[model samples]
Target: MAASGISFRVAQAVGVGGALWLSGNIAALSLISIPALVRSQTEDSVPTSILSRQWKYTFEAGKSQNPPIAVATATSFCYLAWSVRAGTQLGRLVPRNSIALYCIAAILTIGIVPFTIIAMTPTNSRLIAIAEQKRDAGGSVKPNDEPVEVLMKKWMFLNGIRSFLPLLAGATALVAVLG
Candidate 1:
């Protein structure tokens, strides 16, 4: 079935919007939020439990929200690719390579899931474990400051890398559309 003009436009918008939204949020989390939290911890001598709890909350919130957006964005990109390939515009001048670009965008967007699971799960698991341990101990155990900071630093670095996937996806899709 051919995509109506309006349908194609909407799907493009969604794909573009969702990819950017995912990228921006992850960027903010990695660049702004987590850094600020860590800085606060260092400046204020915040307790382990409190610090871990804050990080935990932030991590949990993102975990809940980001995956779905990635999936949705990928779906939209795939649809756009199919629409273009299926000849949505009879006389429109979509390049032959646009389909490949759209497929690349969709792959990049959706690939964040397994990327996170495979690359980030160990760090995430350790951080969560620290938070849980501190919480379970009634927020009394301080543990080693170095370990917590080390983990946080590692997580921030990994997260920063992860943010780029969606960014690349958005750029790829936008370029394909504009061409």
Candidate 2:
């Protein structure tokens, strides 16, 4: 019935439901696998048997990373679908409230993107090398070295900006529909 234009609202509801269901499952898997990955990373300090077993499980489904990445993509789809539904629902049902919903959706979507990216990206040890270089060159290094946190905050700020464009596009579409 998806091919048929049964009703935009019905279709949207189905689509949003599917996205939410898939996202929930993916989020569960991510929550499960994340700790295992962390355990594997710290495996060296653990028993060899335990380390090997954790490492094997972590990589068993293909690569050590595929599952997480797949989950990431699924989550992204979830967010995109959620945004669509929010815009559509707001416009259709609460025309006056659409603006508020649009803004909220945009903020949430934008806020999540950077966190997702940072979670997925591997930490580059080379970044520390650069930091070290500056310190060795007699450059004044800050007493409290909080590089990772600093970078994460910056990345999140940029991600908010990154998310704004698509969200703004969605909001624009919503405004057009309302007018």
Candidate 3:
């Protein structure tokens, strides 16, 4: 019983803490980093190479960092859910609602990976290709695609949507905890 409580606390800490941290990181990029970069230039046109490098650096970093956090968070939440599932530890003591909420958190937290692959991949690929093409040209190369700002704006929108997942996951877990 004491061991179960200790493990439960650990899982709750990781699940809730990781969800909030992931959401905060993603939200900062969508709300602060991307917009600041997009608005930095005073000219009518923004530079593709600059945007590309910036996007590439941040995207790569996030791609490496966020998925692991998401997985850990979801795994923690899964532990919580499994603890309360049938024929499992603490199943009799913990309520059914928390199990359901933890399951939801696990889904929403881990869902960011597939969301990025499916929903954000097109824009990411386009940006990467444009960046490679234009970085050496020093923005003198006329883009064959849409304006870099337009594409970036689209990316910001998509990223904003993505940021909500972990936030929602965190909120769900919080609700479960409060209950």
Task: List candidate 3 segments past 4 Å from native.
Answer: 43-46, 134-139
lDDT of 1 by residue, 1-179 (tens): 24466787888899999999999999898899888878887998887777777889999999999999999999999988887785456225588888889999999998788889999999998888878873444557556545777788889999999999999999999999888
Assess the local accuracy of residue 105 in candidate 1 as a C-alpha lDDT between 0 and 100: 97
Model 3: which residue pairs collide? none
Number of the top-ranking candidate, with lDDT as the measure: 1
Better of 2 and 3 by TM-score: 3
Worst 10 residues of 2 by lDDT: 122-131
Ranking by lDDT: 1, 3, 2
TM-score of each predicted structure versus truth:
0.91, 0.32, 0.91
How high a TM-score does candidate 1 get?
Answer: 0.91
Say what the RMSD of model 2 is: 11.5
Distance (Å) between predicted and true CA of 61, model 3? Answer: 1.2
Question: What's the lDDT for residue 115 in model 1?
Answer: 84
